[model samples]
Target: MDKKTHFDFVTSIGLMILSLVMIVDSYRMGVDVGGALYASPGMLPMVLALLLLLTSAMLLKRSIRNGGARQNLAGFVAWFDIFRKSRMAREMMVGALILALYTFVLAPRLPFWMSTSMFMILLMAILKATSLVKNLMITALVVGSIYGVFQMVFHVPLP
Candidate 1:
């Protein structure tokens, strides 16, 4: 079996399931389009789920028609392949860990804007941003824009 096609198919199926779950959960939560668009709690999740479903369907179709990364993948899964093949694997793993920590721990405990700002700066540093001033400036701008759009404009509640 083509490795790329197989992986793509699996990922598509997984995403489809997740999308279905999100859609169902939103409906169960009484989120309905009959109400005003902005006030509906389920609108964003519904939209996101539909978008994911569409993308997953497209990926599934493409994978079925054209294979990706055709190679024998029957053997035991090589979990350390990233470490063996690339030098940036460690940094990538650390980034993922940092993201998880920020999401589960910091975001809930601290204010969203502050936590997000710290997370952005830390991510920039992790990605090898050399200048402290540049990283701070860029991260502040990004955090401000995000806060302004989500909290001020959209009026989404933040911790």
Candidate 2:
């Protein structure tokens, strides 16, 4: 298949996997609360995961119908080569890596606001989207807003 179709196929598979994981985790969170299914803490997450799974399945079917299933080893290799050589693809990969690092590494170790600020600053710096001072100001505003919303409005503790 073409690049777009190949990309869609890959993305669908990833989404399916992610949705499955979410489904499992949400299920483990307990699907029923006080005899009420909708009252469960996991209800919304489970519903969202199911929706994502359904959409991913549809995408997968469409990709396969559009010749994605005909892609062979050589074609896959060629696609990877093209992806590796593209500047946009490289930037996207870097951005994804940074997000993963922030989620899995930094968030677990640091306070919520501090980790979020660091993530925003690092991401903007790596993307060269703005000057350091501007990035810091933007990060501060965004994180402060998040903190205020969670702590004051929602009465929720951030971690």
Q: lDDT per prediction?
A: 0.77, 0.86
Cα lDDT of model 2 by residue, 88-131, tens digit: 99999999999998989999999998889989998999899999
In terms of TM-score, which candidate is strongest?
2
TM-score for each predicted model, relative to the true structure: 0.50, 0.58
Compared with the true structure, the alpha-carbon lDDT of candidate 1 equals 0.77
| Model 1, span 14-124: residue lDDT tens | 899999999998775554445776667887888999999999999977876664423222211342363546768878877998899899999999987788888888888
Model 1 TM-score (2 dp): 0.50
Worst 10 residues of 2 by lDDT: 68-77
Off by over 4 Å in 1: 1-85
| Leading candidate by lDDT | 2
